[model samples]
Target: MTAPTPRAILEYGLSSGNVGLVQLLGLCPLLAVSNNAVNALGLGLATVLALTATNTAVAGIRRLTRRDVRIPAFILVIAAVVTSIELAMRAWLPALHAVLGLFIPLIVTNCALMGRAEAFASRHDPARAALDGFATGLGFLWVLLALGAVRELAGEGSLFAGAGHLLGLPGLELVAAGYPGFVPAVLPIGAFLALAGLVALRQGWRLRRAGAGA
Candidate 1:
């Protein structure tokens, strides 16, 4: 494969090698916390923070770690970072943090974070690692936002419900008017169904665009 440029790296993170698309990692939290925009944004930001910190730290210490034990060491760094973020969330954003629940700690297990650390961060400079982390994290964030928007609109007939709390604007519950909510759209199974449909739609669009270009 050709060497990845900075722009290419960013593009890959925003789309192609996205945790949901290329790596297919962290689906559990992706589906679980994506019930609303606020929840999705919170989880997405946490994940980005975890990935960036872990990747940067790993890259900085790459020469110090033995190859055989690198994976464990990486996990240790990730766990510590995730735990720190989890504590911060619990202490400050208790309500939003509660909505995320176990998934916050679960960021440690998210293969996306580890995958980037092992695959990219281990071999790259700190600057490159930071870029990779931001790109990959942003990619994951985009998907979570899309999924959350779909779920929230369909499930609750709203968007960004309870967003003001996160922004420190207390007592704001933004609800759309005259909306018909579909309860199943917010459920676990609904996440799978929606994701599958989106995949299908994306495929169809790709095929149609290819045909037109041809």
Candidate 2:
């Protein structure tokens, strides 16, 4: 097979590394803030911004950074970008900033960000590096949204609770009363169980599809 193009590299990063599904990076905020869709979306957006900025910056300076010091330089760059994002979030989206809490700053330490910077951005052109970051970030966001939906539905018997506050759109509320239980969808244990179940379900679906194709 011919060598994969930069665009293909990015697509693989998103679908394969899969900060949520495969690599399982950034699980702390994934489980914690995912109690609600708005919370998850807020963090996911921040992460995407941080990743894109870091990747681009790193790519731009890759030529100047020496091989021995590249890793530290990459981290410093990522941290600076994440800090800027954190400050912006604090200024404009204070409520979301509050809900996200430490995780906002913690994006600096997220391996997924650093990994992309070191593995992809350092070796690729700026455009491709940025695309890789965007793809990976989007993949991460998708899983966070799905997890938030499942948890919110099970925990509160509703989807998008308090969504108006996040979306800043009026009269867009979804609520379902008579909720049975919240134990399996709000707790840390619940997060683990839910994630495990999702993995198993995906595996089963893949297996079934394979069998059908055969």
Candidate 3:
């Protein structure tokens, strides 16, 4: 198959081919940590970094690896990259890292990482692979942001609370004072409910577009 164009990359990886909506990768952390905007963006940024670095490294070393051992090689590369990301988070974003916990290291197992490696980066050049990685991560990030924001507003009556701790940007947390949040939204069931609503909304939009086209 031919490599996707830059615009196509963005459209698919960020919008049409959204990891949450379409590909449905990395749901473990998605449902667990998306209680607020801060956690979502923090993990999203980390995943973005992992994806970009993993893609670039995989593409850079593709020519040297044997075809038969490619899968293992990719795994090892991804592990190393994810570890590096984890350490950086621990050092600079300790609070966010603690909140995220095991999920940080679990990035190595995210199918999105491996999928991009074998499907795109292995065949494409580094620059294109990097672009694809960023786009893909952006897609995932957008979902995380939406989910986190919605849950925070509904569950805790606040927005972006504790957000700055991740990026060290003050004033990121916004509190909706005097609002009594829905408790269910902060629980595991709440993640499912919120995710279901999001998926439904996306499908509704697609259906509307189809009807318009028809």
Candidate 4:
């Protein structure tokens, strides 16, 4: 919550929104869409857009919005941005939109967005709020991309398969034959396992960093 310097904000977003690290605030989409790279990337991008827009809006209106009603105001801002994004995705990326389904609209409820708006955006200037939102979104996107790649590779024996459907490219899909498919990697349980491993790795890195600093 203490997002000050640009570097600090970046680190905060990266560590907190790691999806596998300390702040697992937004898991619904993370777990659901992470089964494939395209879906993960799509959702991640949407979240980034939402967070950035909402944060900026909230920051700009902080003085106008009263404290008691700020949360609702923030949600409304986020919902508007998310709705616009959802519509655009549905029109242009219909296949990906359908796959994301209800979760696409549900980005309104993502705590990470609201949390940043209320805690960071409301107090910070527009510039800082935007930076924080983008940094945080990048963090979330990083996790999604990594998880998606891992699951897609392990479960489908291919990487970025059917990417053309999302990218509008005819030959974007690629395949690898060597991966003996593991069905579990694409399952919900697999998400948990993969996230756990990622969390452990992050914690270990932090410990090493702390020791070196000491």
Candidate 5:
């Protein structure tokens, strides 16, 4: 099949082709660090940076890469990009970096990033590959942001509790100070439940669209 147009690539990444919601890749970090909005945002930004850089580098060097060594080469490129981002974050945003510690380095192992490098970037030009990476990363970012917001609000009765420190935004508490938070919403089980709901919702929407078109 022919590759999607640039606009389609961007649109799909934001919606139907979301790495988190649709492809369902890289759920370990997605679930682990999304307890709050600030952590989610921090990790999401790092993923975006890593994905974009990896795709660009892979696409730029596709011709020079031997088919047999492509997988390892792609992994090396991804590792280098992730390492650079991780180091930069550690230097500039130590607190946020510390908060997202293991996950930052784990970006190199994210199948979503690897999938894009091998499937799309390897076949496309650098400009298009970069766009795909950005779009794909943005898709993953929004899901993390939404899930984190939901979990935080449900579990802590507030949103962006540490935004002032990590993301430089004012923290907002929607509920009274006395509000008893939902313990389950911030737990590992909660991540599974929340992601299930989102996946279901997406599938439902797809069904509706298919029915309408049919």
Candidate 6:
């Protein structure tokens, strides 16, 4: 197998290795908070901040950390970063923070962050680790946004329905006033179906690319 180039490493989390659609990491928050675009964006940004900071911190102290204590050290780093983000949100974006609720604190439990710290940040320089975290976070963000948009549009006939809380802007209503939205699209089962659809689309694109190369 060929070793990953810098470009591949940088883009991995955002494309083929997306934590949401590809790796299915952090599904609890991904599904729970993604009922609308604004919530998804809020959570996504928080996750990004947590991941990038934790990865950088881990990489910076990697040499100092003993092998036996590395896992605990990484968890502490991740939790601290996440706690900072949660506090900032509580102070600045209280409405969005309330909407996200327990999920914000739950970011500490996201396996994807731990996976990156152990698999990439520990082995790479701080710059590369930060990039990986940002890229991975972006990958995760896009998936959340897409899933949220689809579910919101289908269920509520609108997009960014809660934007006033996050962005201070009213949401857009795509359908007529009388349009009866599909209720199931915003339910828990809808998240599963929508995510599956996204995964299938990604797989189809990959198949086409492979065939073209062949």
TM-score of each: 0.92, 0.91, 0.96, 0.93, 0.94, 0.94
Q: Which residue pairs does candidate 4 place in steric collision?
A: none
lDDT of each: 0.86, 0.82, 0.90, 0.86, 0.89, 0.88
Error of 3 at 88 (Å): 0.9
Per-candidate RMSD vs. true structure?
Answer: 2.0, 2.1, 1.2, 2.0, 1.7, 2.1
- How many residue pairs clash per model? 0, 0, 1, 0, 0, 0
Per-residue lDDT, model 1, residue 67, is: 88
Per-residue accuracy of model 2 over 40-81 as CA lDDT, tens digit each? 788888888888889999999999999999998998898889
Q: How many backbone overlaps does candidate 6 show? A: 0
Stretches off by above 4 angstroms in model 6 are 1-6, 171-176
lDDT of 2: 0.82
Sorting all predicted structures by lDDT, with the top scorer first, yields 3, 5, 6, 1, 4, 2
lDDT, model 6, position 156: 85
After superposition of all CA atoms, the RMSD between model 3 and the true structure is 1.2
Per-residue CA lDDT of model 6 for 67-167, tens digit only, reads: 99999999999988999999998998888888889999999999999999999999888988888899889888999999999998888888886586566
Ranking by TM-score: 3, 5, 6, 4, 1, 2
Best by lDDT: 3
- Quote the positional error of residue 36 for candidate 2 in Å: 1.6
After superposition, the stretches of candidate 4 with alpha carbons farther than 4 Å from their true spots are 1-3, 16-20, 170-172
- lDDT per residue (tens digit) for residues 9-110 in model 5: 899889978999988999999899889878988899888888889999999999999999999999989988988998888888888887888989988888
Alpha carbon lDDT at 168, candidate 6: 72
Alpha carbon lDDT at 51, candidate 6 = 88
Poorest stretch of ten by lDDT in candidate 4: 16-25
Clash pairs of candidate 3?
160-173
Q: Kindly list the per-residue Cα lDDT of model 3 for residues 40-97, writing each as its tens digit.
A: 9988999999999999999999999999999999999999999999998899888888
